[model samples]
Each structure stands twice: as C-alpha cells, then as structure tokens.
Target: MNVWREDLLTRLSAAHSATEVFSVIEREGKALGFDHLAYGVRFRYPLSNPRIVLLNNYPEQWQTLYAERGYVKIDPIVMRGMVSQIPIVWSEHYSRASNTFWEEARQFGIAHGWSQSATDCRGLQSLVSFVRGAEYLGSAELTANGARLSFLAHAGHEYMCHQLARDHHAQDSGELTTREIEVLRWTAEGKTAGEISILMGISDRTVNFHAANAMAKLNCANKTATAVKAAILGLLD
Candidate 1:
C-alpha cells in the first residue's frame, strides 16, 4: 500500500469514537480531492427494524432536507449498494429514479461524486461517498483511485462497526460470554435445547443452563426473545 493509504488505515483503526472516525475520513477524503464526504452504515440482523447510522459534512440545509424528505429510503445509490459492490459515479442519466434528489444535491454544490460500499461478516453494510462541485469524477479519475477508495470504504466500515457495537453493548447494560453467544446464535436458528446439546456436544441440561443465563443477561422473557435480541444486537454476527 502507499503511504497515504497505510497512514489513513492506521488512523481509522485507532479511532475510538464516531467523531474521531469522521475526522479521519474528512481529512483523508479532502487529501484525495473530495470537497465533501459522507459515510453511512446499516445493520441487517433484526429483519424487523434495522439500525442505520450516517455521518456527513454536507451543508446543514441539505442534510435537513434529505432527512425530512426520507431520501434514504429512495436513494438509488444506496439501493445499488445493497446488491452490488461496484463503485458508482453520480450522474443524472443513471439516477433517473431520484432526479429531484440529485438536482437538489447539485444545488448544494455536489455536482460530481462517487460512492463505494462494503459489507462485513456481521451483516453491517457501509457506504462512502465523495463529492465535489467543480471537478468531474471521470473514468480516468476512478481508474486511478478505485482500489484506494474501496479500501477506505471497507476499513472505515469495520472501524465504525467496532465502535458502534461497543457503544451499543454498553447501552444494553450487560455482556454475554462466548458460550452464551454461541448457544444464542444456534437458538436463533430455531434449535431446541436437545438439538443445541447434540450440536454443541453438551448435555441438554447444560444447553438449557446456557440459554437461561443468556436470557437473563439479555433481559429476555424467553428463549425466543433472547435469540431475537441477540440477533438484533449483532451477537449472532
């Protein structure tokens, strides 16, 4: 890797909080010639109600307008990220579905942009987008920086995932042991105590014991709820 990429990854890995991570991204993004930067993450475990986090240096009014209009739900770039890992350059031709959104983004001096996405083993999906007003991000530019941009997207996602998971665990008020997590993960797959015991090579009573402890730690009323809670908290990941 180049010095620029190595240094940026080092800084990102050392970042302990969301703000610190955002700062690292902003600095590195500007160094790469972007005028604005945005990073967004979404969790995929809950299936019922997923969690999303966004960090951006966009204009305040644009941010407010985007949120107020629920643009996240309809952003074509985001939709593409869900199914493919391809890097995308912003253009009205490809963003016909969200023409108005793209137009408004241009009004905020976001005329040229590119985005790439990364998904982790924990089912956390992250997208990094860089935008500028004057310079167009053409094929030549993408060819020059594509590898580094993809790396940034992945590393940033991993760092942010670790920080967010730590914070969420703290807020959950308890921690699960390795055995507890293992048992809960299997349980989430509809495994009963007997099945879990066979899979884990433990007694059924032991399986129940672990399940009971996990339920208590998670403050769940039953095993079903415990499994769901664990999945939602990304423990299954």
Candidate 2:
C-alpha cells in the first residue's frame, strides 16, 4: 500500500472515539479528492426491528431535510447496498427510481460520489460514501482507487463494531469453553441435543448442559438463539 493509504488505515485503527475516527476519515477523504464523507451502520438482527446509525460531515441543513423527508427508505443507492457489495457511483442512472430524491440531493451539493459497503458475520452492515460537488467521478478514478477504498470501508466497519461493542457493556459475559463452542457450532447447524451428543460421543444431557451454559453467557433465551448469536459473532470460527 502507498504511505497515504497505509497511514490512514493505521490512524483509523487507533482512533479512540467515533468522532475521532470520522475526523480521520474526513481528512483523508478530502486528500483523496472528495469533499464530504458519511458512514452508516445498520444492525440487522431481531428481524422485527432493525436499527441504524449514521455519522456524517454532511451539511446540517441537508441532514435535517433528509431525515424530515425520511429519505433513507427511498434512497436507491442505499437500497441496492443492502443486497450487493459492488461500489455504487451516484448518478442519474442508478437513482432513476428515486429521481426526485437524486435531484434534491444535487440541490444540496451532493453532485458526484461513490459508496462502498462492508458486512460482518453478525449481520451488521455499513456503508462509506465519499462525495464531492464538482468533477465527475470517472471510471479511471474508480479503477485506480477501488481496492483501497474497499479496504477503507471494511477497516472503518471493523473499528466501529469493536468500539460499539465495548461501549455497550457485555454484562459480565464469559468466554465459551471449547466444549460449549462445539455444541453451539453444531446447534447452529440445526442439530438437536440428541444428534449432537451422538456425533460428539457424549450424552444428550451433556449437550444440553453445554448449550444452556452458552445461552446464559450469550444472554440468549434458548439454545437456538445462543447458537445463532455465537456463530454470527464468529465464536464458532
């Protein structure tokens, strides 16, 4: 990596707070030819209601307008990002479905930009968008910086997730033992205690014991939830 990119990643990894992290991203983004930066994370568990957090250096007036209009739900670039990892270049073509929204964004000086996304095993997804008002986002620019930009997105996501987890106390969480991990791993594969016991050469009672302990540590209500959470958190890996 070039010194510029390498130093940015290093600084991002060591940032002490959300503000500090975004500050670094903003400074580096400007150096890379962008005028504004935004990062957003969506926690997608609890299917009934997912939560989202957005941090940006967007103009306050534009931010208020966006929220008041409930634009996130109607933003096509954001919608496409939910299912695909491809970097999206903001343009009339991609935002055709949300033409009005696109025009509004342009009026606020959101003229040209591109976004990159990163998804974690825990079903938490994040997008990093670097935008500027002037110069078109040419293919040559994307061709040159795509990989580094992708890396920047993921590095930002990693630190944000870690910081958020730490800020929210785990409530005295304990590490799952090797046996507990084995049971949860199999449980995540949709195996019952009886099946797990036979496969691991243990009693069904022992399998249930491990699963229950894991559930307590993970604060899940049942074996299934425990397994799912553990696997998603990469405890199994």
Candidate 3:
C-alpha cells in the first residue's frame, strides 16, 4: 500500500473529531503529490448555499474565477457525481462535450488524473476530488492509477463519515426516525422536497415533514444550517 494511503487509514482510525479527520485528509492529499484536494457539500435547494472545504493548492485567483463565474452551476462532473452512488474518474467525464470545467481546467495545468467520489450522508451530498497537474496525470498514467485513486477516495469519504459520527456520539438530540434521517441526508444534497419525494416514492408533504422534524431536532435556523450542523454532528452519515 502507498504510504499516504496507510497514513490516511491510520489517521481515520484514530480520529475523534471532524477537524482532525479533515486535517488528515489535507495531509494525505499533500502526501499523494496532488495539487489540491476539495471536499464540498452541495445542498438541494438553490436557496441553500453549498459548503466547501479546500485542502491545499487551490489558487485564490482560480477560486475566485470558479465561484464568480458560476462554474459549479454548469459543471457536468459535479452534476453527474451528485446523482451517482459510485466513484467517477475525471478523465472519462472530461470527454463529454458538455463538460464545462474541462476548458478552464486545461488552462490551469490541471492534470487529467482528477477523480471524484460522492456519498449521500443523510441527504447532504459530499464529494471529494483529487486533482493533479497536467504533466503528472497524463491519460495513460491516470488509467494505471485509477483503481488506487478510487480506493483512496472511498476511504476518505468513509473516514469523514466515521469522524462525523464520533463527534455526535455523545449528543442527545431527539431520536430521528430512519426516514427522517434519509430526508435530511437528501436535503443536505440540495434536493428539492419534490425531487426527494419522487426519489423516495413518498409525498412531498411527507418529505417536508421529515425535514421539519430533523431541523427541529438539530435546532437549526434553516435547511442549510441544519445540514451543516448534521455534518458536524455526524448525523448525516
């Protein structure tokens, strides 16, 4: 196993807090020789802003451009990943003509080695992306390392979930029914109540009910805050 992978596993095993786990993930990205690592949580509703965590190597200029340009709205990789339960290699998605991020990414010397894996934890969608430089992550090289990257990405998500759970283990909020947890998880992912209702094969009103109950238990001001607090408490995972 790669030393970075081993280190990641060790840190995750020992992590008692979300901060500690995220710190380890940052270090793991650095150790893997990537330009940066980003983990973001996208909410279902447009009104709810997404939450982001940057690891290392995202330039301020690039960050500004990415956000100011509304790139996320048109980012095909993100859109696809949100609906997928499995991992996706960035290189494969880059081939699509509709992938808006590709042009901008190439200009940034971003490697083709990028890959993302997503998990739905209590309605919040968490995605972790590993990005490298163009020279470092050529097509051929990416093909060779794809499996390993997938493993690492999945491990990273699992680590986050474990840490989140540990953080909330001692808290005594009102017990949320399984359906409520499911609704909150999707709500965190930026899903509309109607969309969630369709996905769960339930009524929109039922979806709203679960969300309302979850928010009350979490004592959050709104859906976005509730999602964030749920993540912090490890309730989503």
Candidate 4:
C-alpha cells in the first residue's frame, strides 16, 4: 500500500471526530489526482447523516444543483454503493442503470470517470465518491487502484464514526429508528423528500412522514429549521 493509504488507516484508527476524518479524505483526494471527493453517512444517529464536505475544485454550480435538486436519489453511483460493501467504479454503475439525471450530471461536469466505495462503520453505512475528468479508466489501472480506494473508504468511515461517538457534544436528544435517522440525516444534508425516498428505496410520502416525525421531535417549524437544529445539537458536523 502507498504511504498515504497507510497514513489514512492510522488516522481512521485514531480520529476522534467526523471533521478530522473529513479532512483526511479531502487531503487524500488532492493527493490522488482526483478533482473532488465526498463522503456521506446513513445511520440512526443524528450525527450519522449524509453530510458532505468538499475537497475543493468541484464547481459551485454543480454543488448547488446537487443539493437543490436532491440528486442523491437519482445518483445510481451512490445508490449502488449503499447496497454493497465494495469499491466500485462509476462506469460500472452507468452500465447497469440509465436515468435522465445521469445526463444532467454529465452537463454539470460530474460524469465520465469516477470511482466509489461503500463502508459499513459499525451499524452505519456510507459512500465515498471520487471524480476525475475523463470517460473511462483502463482495466489495468482499475485493478491496481481498486484496493487502495476501498482502503480509503473504509478508513474514512471508521475515522468519522469514531469521532462522532467520542464527542459528547455530537449527541442529540431522542433516539430514532434506523430508517428515520437515515431520512433525517439526508434531509439535514439538504436532500429533498423525493430524493431521500429514492435513495432509501421508499416512497416520497414515506420520506415526508419521516421528516415530519423528525421535525416534531426536534420541535422545529420546517425542514430547514430542523436541519439547523440538527447541526446545533451536534447531530451533524
């Protein structure tokens, strides 16, 4: 393994907060020649939500659209990773699914070449996505780097979860079910009900129901406010 990969493993083992793990992933993306990186968690805990911290270089417009349109639902790459605990390349997902959103993603400079991995951190799961400015990668290159990417994803999730667990401030009031937590976390990450529904394999109505329940428990007026409260309560970082 590369020195950076080893370093990431060590960091994951030692990280005491989500912010610290995010930093390591951001740094790794820059070192690995990728243009962008994002890690999002789906779990019952308030802090275990689909929070994404950019590594720089991703276009502002793309980010805005991604959040505004709730693209996570239609993002096959993310969906595929969530269901499986394995490293994957973007092209593999594209080959299996077709959606209008994928075309839209291309227009936003997010298509073509990418790789991703899924990690199960304790009972929570997350995906780490990486994008490059190309259409494809050779089998040889993919073979050589696949394991490394998996390592990064595993370490990143471990580090983030460890940090969230250790930081007392990260805890929130009222425990939630796994599905409810997943919905709330994605909502806090700015995903729309429709988007969350798609990502979680549920209906839009179901997504809204979960959000409403979460809002009531959190004593918030709206989704936006609920998200803010989640952040303040250290449910997200």
Candidate 5:
C-alpha cells in the first residue's frame, strides 16, 4: 500500500464534517495533478426524484452554466461512471458525448477528466471525478494512475457517505421510542395503521399516535415518509 494513500484514507475517514472531507479531497486532487475535483451522490429512494448531492471546485461560471444548462443529464463521465466498475478517463472527443456541453465546458477550463463510481451498502451510488484544464491523459498516464484513482473514488465515496449519514442522523431531532419504532417498522412493511393496530393488539388511535410521534422525531412529513426514513437510517432495525 502507498503511504500517501494510507494517510489520505486516514484523514478522510477521520473527517468530522462534509466540508473537511471535501477539503482533503480537493487538496489531494491538486496534488494528484488535477486542478478540479467533483463528487456526487445519488440517493437510493424516491424513484421519481432520487435526490442528488454534488460538490465541486470548478470555476463559478462553469458551475452556473452547468446547473442552468442541466449538463448532468449529458455528462459522459457521470453516465458511464454510474455503471462502470473501473476508473474511466473521459475526454471531450468521445463520440457519444454532447459536443455543445463539452465545448461550453472547455471554454470554462474543464477538459481532461477521470471518474469512477462506487455503490454503498444501501444501494446509494456516489462518483468522484478529477479534472484539469490541460494535459490529456494518454494510455500510459492512465495506466500509471488507474489504481490510485480507483482507490480515491471508493475511499472518498465511503467517507462522504459517512458524513452524509451523520448529517441525516443529526436531522432526526430525537430518538424514536420503542413503540414508535415498532409502529414505523410495521408501517414500512406496507401495513396500514388499522392493520398494524390489529397486529400489535393496539387500538387504531394508539397506532396513529405512535406513527405521528415517529414522524415528528424523524422530521418527516407523514407516516409513510417517516417509516421510510426510519428504515433508511436503520432506526427500524
């Protein structure tokens, strides 16, 4: 194992906040010869709107343009990285890449890039990218950096998800009581409050009471979201 990589992983895993994690990653990316670093995590639930969390150090203009133009929908690295199990050296010259998007990105000083994605235990997918304005990556360069980049992608994803999970847990406001957890767990099984009441030998009003309390503690809008949030946070386990 590389000493630098061991130190990097230690620092990342020890990070106390998302900002600290990104700081370590940005500095490491620069040390690795890239001028910019980016990472994104796509949440696992809510199939209609799987939330995306993105962090990047790209130029401000590029960030604005990318968001306004919705370039994520056409980004080749993100597209392939989400499904690929290896580090991918992506370029603007790829056949299927959006020429307009790449042209705009280049004008803003984002050219050469490499990316890889990793999936967490909960099926969440996260990707890390290293980008620079110059120095195209040749086959030799790719070979030299492939393993390290893969390590960075996976290690970065792990700690990023760690910080994210911490944030989620923090937002829970308070711990769920035993009855509240049991109610939510049953609700997660697609059981209606009435059914859960019958199953638990409790009255319908008492079931609703527990579910409502769980929702409040979890900071969720309603019983369904409360149940799902509890399950995601492993509170139901």
Candidate 6:
C-alpha cells in the first residue's frame, strides 16, 4: 500500500467507535490541506425513510444552525451525492438556485470544499467532504489530487461500514432472538400482529409479545421503526 493508504488503515485499525473514526478522518483531512471534515452514512431500505448519521468537526454554532434550519434537507452537495457517485467541488454556481445555503456556509467558515461518495454491498452510502479557509481549488489541483481525495472518501466510508457491520452482528447476537426476527420480518412485510399470529400459528397475544420484545431490544419508537431498523441492519436478510 502507498503511504496514504497505509496510514488510513493503521488509524482505522486503532479506532473503536464512530467518534474515534471521525477523529482519524479529521487528522487525515488536515494533512490533505483541509481544516474541517464532514462524514455522513446513509443506510438503504425503507425506500421512504432511511437511516443516516452525520459526523463533523464544524463549528458548534454552525452545527446547531444547520440542524435548526434543516439545511441538510436542501444541501446541494448532499442532494447530488444521493444519486451520483462523482466527486463535487463546491462553487458559487453550485448553490445559485438554493436559498443562500452556500453563503450561510461561508459565514461559518466552510468555504472551498470538496465532497465524494461511495456505496458498499450492504447498501450503506457514505459521503465525505473536506473544507478549508482560503485557497481556491483550481483544475490543476483537482487533476493532481482528485484521486487521492476520492480514496480518502472511500477509505473513511469502508472503515465506518465495517464498524457498523460488526456492531450490527454484536447487536443481533445479543438483542434479537430468532422469534423476534421472524415477527419483525412479518411486520416489515406489512402484516399486522393478528395476521402474523395466524400465519405463525401463534396466539395474537404471543405475536404482540414478540413484537414488543423486538421493539424494546431494538430501542425503536414503534413496530414500524423496529422492522425498518432490522431490515437496514441486514438482520432480516
């Protein structure tokens, strides 16, 4: 492996949690001439609503503002990455149609950024972005470093997905029983407790019992969320 690849693997091997992984990414981003980094993972399934996580070392005020204003819902970079795997370099024109999203980001010192995305076999999509203060990212720079930047995105994404897979396996082993999975799968298939009970040859009360147990174990808000979470984690597969 080259130096960047070797360094990334070494750091990821030492990372035990998402926070640690983000820290490693932050260091790597800085070394690659960035001051801030943002990483997000989106899990597939439940085509209507998927699970997502965002990690960043952005200013606290900006983080709060972004959430309160729901900037993510309209972020051009995020919207583009959802359908395209191409790397994006932020530009004024990119946000021209959006409602001052880029301007607001600049106010928070998040100007001049690049973003790239990658997807894994498990249907996990990862988008990694790096931002710096002043220097413009011209074409020549992109020609020279775009591949490395793309590699960085992939590296961080794959490492996080690996961690997620491990956590899911551990969670499945401890939290979800076979019966619970059966109930959840049926629930995901749009079956009510009554219908599931009839199909499974169990009492309605017993069906609800398993569903409730699964919900509690999965720490879900409702049966729907529990079913979706299980499917996204590949526990249903």
Which candidate tops TM-score? 5
lDDT for each residue of candidate 6 in 15-69, tens digit (9 for 90 to 100): 9987788888888788778999998888674468776778888999999999999
Cα lDDT of model 4 by residue, 111-138, tens digit? 6554455444245566677776654666
For model 3, how does the per-residue alpha-carbon lDDT over 1-237 read when each residue is reduced to its tens digit?
688567668878897766676677666666656766776654332235534444335667777788888887776667777778565666666666344567766667554545565655444456777776654456675666666667667776776755554444434367778998888788888898899999999999998888888888867777767766766556667
Candidate 6's C-alpha lDDT? 0.83
Better of 2 and 4 by TM-score: 2
The TM-score that candidate 5 achieves is 0.90
TM-score-wise, the better of 1 and 5 is 5
- What TM-score should be assigned to candidate 2? 0.75
TM-score of each: 0.82, 0.75, 0.57, 0.59, 0.90, 0.76
How many residue pairs clash in each candidate at the backbone level? Answer: 0, 0, 14, 3, 0, 0
Candidate 3 lDDT: 0.67
* Model 3 poorest ten-residue lDDT run: 42-51
* Each model's lDDT: 0.81, 0.80, 0.67, 0.67, 0.83, 0.83
lDDT of 2 by residue, 97-159 (tens): 567777778788887888878888767788889998889988899888877777777777888
Arranged by lDDT with the best first, the candidates are 6, 5, 1, 2, 3, 4
Identify the superior model by lDDT, candidate 2 or candidate 3. 2
Model 1 Cα shift for residue 16 (angstroms): 1.0
Which of the two candidates, 2 or 6, achieves a greater lDDT against the reference?
6
